[model samples]
Target: MEDIAEAAAYGVAAPSAASSGAVRRPAAAPVAAGAPPGMAAAPAAPAPPMAGGLAAAAPPSAPRTAPPAEAAPVMGGVLQKEALGLVEIVPFRGVRRTMARHMAESVAKQAQVTTMDEADVTIIKRIREKERTVAAERGVRLTYLAFAIKACTAALKRFPRLNAVLKESGEEFVLKRYYNIGIAIDTKSGLVVPNIKAADTKSIFEIAAEIVDLVDRAEQRHLGVDELHGGTFTITNYGAIGGVYATPVINYPEVAILGMGRVRELPVVHEGKVLTRLLLPLSLTFDHQLIDGAEAARFLNLVMSYLEDPDLLLLEGA
Candidate 1:
């Protein structure tokens, strides 16, 4: 009774348990001397020391690894199992398989870093508007992506390091003198990047027409294998799907990848006056092993400059 009174004086839980004819439990362990009333409960008692501290631990369960059954047809890695679920189960192959493998390789091999910025594309927007009808008359659909490609290659020329690929041997970076820019196109089957060879030398209208042809052929899954190779750089415009900004993965073998976001009108201060300017979000993901943060920022700034004053591309892109 006196012990219970002393415990109650400290405002802590009293140590009580079932009396006779009731279930029993271990007594509450002692709180430390000078421990506050609401201090944490005492830790459970340690297990009894193993005999000689050398008792044998049970052997680890057999390691589970991917099956290596290749005695028959169908090369290894594909398991033929019975379907046992309500959800759909399909083989991981085809374009989706290729995409998964490449993406995994890129993430595993390269040190990818994404730098984001907004470009004031107001001037290019106006130019695109004026040329829209003209391009249609010539059987082409001029898009801002064409102008963006022009501007990007112009910037790439100045930053040759970002336009190169590190050799598979990792001994050297192969700087591509000519630009073969890959554009990622989403199709019903999967994503395919068929590059425009010598894209830097082509005019905006040419690029626009090529983009249309590539997209059409890609949708029909008719792009030639050669058309998808030999790219030095890649660009993916998630803007068509309404993305504002994103960290895009590098297209392996190439050192960098750039993503374009939707152009939206926003008010901004330009040359001492406020105006509604068309802004495009740009994401530049580069291999950090080759390009540093400052270099990436400078390269993106140059691209943004061309976007802000698109007339400059005419001088450099040609």
Candidate 2:
């Protein structure tokens, strides 16, 4: 089973006959003459209407069409829509069987636990409170997830290797260049991770808006293939459902997954005196294959620092 699982991970075999049977290659469209390789032909234009007996005279300044000899060369390339239709699928061979067995044995598997310090998100809550009205005017809801996503983006920028994939072929891991942050949404059917592409470039409001739309589509099970691919890092807010300090399973392929637990009032020492503060539990599960415990702690610390004083994040963006 272990060998089969490893083989499946490397795309060596299908997970099962049923899973393998689901793989299908999309059909390609015809190419046109003079079109670039892989490019489809442009659609033909409609013919001009026939002249009538009382047709209006042409304008004096009307420009004449240039002859083909003087026409600029047409730059042709395959349309992404057409290319997407030609995607090839490799059947999952080994992982499906192991995945099924793991699902059944999940309760019995000993969880690898690691507890990080709680983050005081009072400032984050305050910012959301202050921006809720303005955000609504912009047609985007201000949520903690937006702030979390921003923090993750900034942290990943500082620590690029954290955004990597683990492969057994080499001792080294592959670090991803683009930042596509995936947010895990729980649906009635199962879990889904819809990614926000080029997340580092979006504003906090934009991130919040996209997150809301993604979650809505996920719940409705209307997400497309593009929304569910190319995740360099993942954030799962299990806290939304009232879970506290859970060791979440790593979303395979991505090196790190950040989990947020419920926020609650807790006593903490500040300015030499104990004070009650609203704190959030954050759990970061990282692939040991890509990052060590120390680096993971630092990444989590960076996120915690931003949450503690979200004003810093706002100023950084400014």
Best by lDDT: 1
Against the true structure, candidate 1 has what lDDT? 0.79
lDDT tens per residue, model 1, 101-211: 778899999999999999998888788788888998989976779988888889998999999988878888889999999999997556778899999888889999999
Compute the lDDT of residue 236 as modeled in candidate 1: 97
Q: How close is candidate 2 to the true structure, as a TM-score?
A: 0.64
Candidate 2 lDDT, 1-318, residue by residue in tens: 573444233222222322222222354455665668568768855545557745455446335433233222122212222444533233333334444454444323323335466789877787788888999998888877888898889888778877987665646678888899999887653456779999989988999999989988766656766676789998989999997787776666666778899989888997799998889899987766557778888889988888888777777772
The 0-to-1 C-alpha lDDT of every candidate, in the order given, reads 0.79, 0.71
* Deviation (Å) of 64 in candidate 1: 47
Clash pairs, model 1 backbone = none
Decoy 1 TM-score against native: 0.72
RMSD of each: 23.5, 20.2
Task: In angstroms, give how far residue 72 of model 2 lies from its true place.
Answer: 72
